[model samples]
Target: MTPLPIAAPLTIAIDGPAAAGKGTLAKRLAAHYGLPYLDTGLLYRAVGRLADEQGVDLDDAEAAGAVARALDAGAIDEAALRGREAGELASRVAAHPPVRAALEAFQRAFAADPRGAVLDGRDIGTVICPGARVKIFVTASAEVRARRRTDELAAKGRTVEYERILAEVRERDARDAGRAAAPLKPAADARLLDTSELDIETAFRAACAIVDQAPH
Candidate 1:
């Protein structure tokens, strides 16, 4: 586990590339600490799904922003949000600055709560909570991530070509890294966790260790 340095309640920002196991780590950390967990990627997924439902063009920034503003947190369905259409739309809508700005308050408010919160996404440390005392950037090689994702999909009975998934992963990475608003990059102070070979339990423990050693 990553040792944390927090003395008291503090937000833990976990940021990373897709399939890097950041989400899994964040959820476990939040559970261990009895804190809230925010999968910020779901926010974009929700907005993108909403846009699709309303027939709003993915490239239309104004339309995407309008959907983003009216998004209700309670309406998000995890299963529905993971559909291929929604995932693609999310990639497109996530590029809009307005959409990101509209969703910022919800994420920030959750992090500001008295109970410590763990937020995982591309820019949680850099944009969502720069003041976060414990920021961990969890990442793995693209090839490794692709293999994991492919295996996961297969295990879930979902048919996906590994090469195609690999290509999409690279494309998403490029888009995320190129976005002007909250691009996927580690904060200078964030500890890097290269979990290309670690399992979720090992990664969680490593992350917990980082939190334990961090100064609150």
Candidate 2:
């Protein structure tokens, strides 16, 4: 039996580990193509923030899953989840199978919209939007990503040590790659972009080329 085709519009999935520039590229791609852009990590971040606000233990999978299920993106305060602490909590919550299951439907629904969308997350290409028109797995070395993250935090007036940030980045990478539920990896048909040496503009342009060249 043949699977039914995905609905119209070009859904783009950009995935990567922490600070790999996937978010930046996704935003640019969405803007260029006038599609809705979603940084799916924000979904988990919102959940983590809820767990923290409600004093739930990060290790309690049931609690985390509950928060994920009740997450209201419209009500989430992105500014509240912008710190390093929120990111760490998000990583822990994201490992819970139930939490991932809870969020998967929301992600799939957004990707299925006919108006088109660009979503960036660890599992976007592999899980959320496998049939997307273009899938890009954007990544860079941990050192490079850490440096980028450090600069970003500094610009945002957040104080964080580079060594500490780097350690956290590597730890998160291990956790994401080793997790049993939707482990972070590129999709079979996804294009890989190593932005270790490329600037944001260059990386965006490279991604644009990939999207432009993909057969509609």
Provide the TM-score for each candidate, comma-separated: 0.93, 0.93
**Regions more than 4 Å wrong, model 1:** 1-8, 83-85
Worst-scoring 10-residue span by lDDT in model 1: 80-89
What is the C-alpha RMSD, rounded to one decimal, of candidate 1? 4.2
lDDT of each: 0.89, 0.90
- How well does candidate 1 match the true structure in TM-score terms? 0.93
Instruction: Give the poorly placed runs of model 2, Cα more than 4 Å off.
Output: 1-8
Give per-residue CA lDDT, model 1, range 143-178, as digits (tens). Answer: 999899899889989999999988988998999899
Strongest candidate by lDDT: 2
RMSD of each: 4.2, 3.4
lDDT of 2 by residue, 68-146 (tens): 9888878878777877788888899999998999999989998987898999999998888888989999999999989
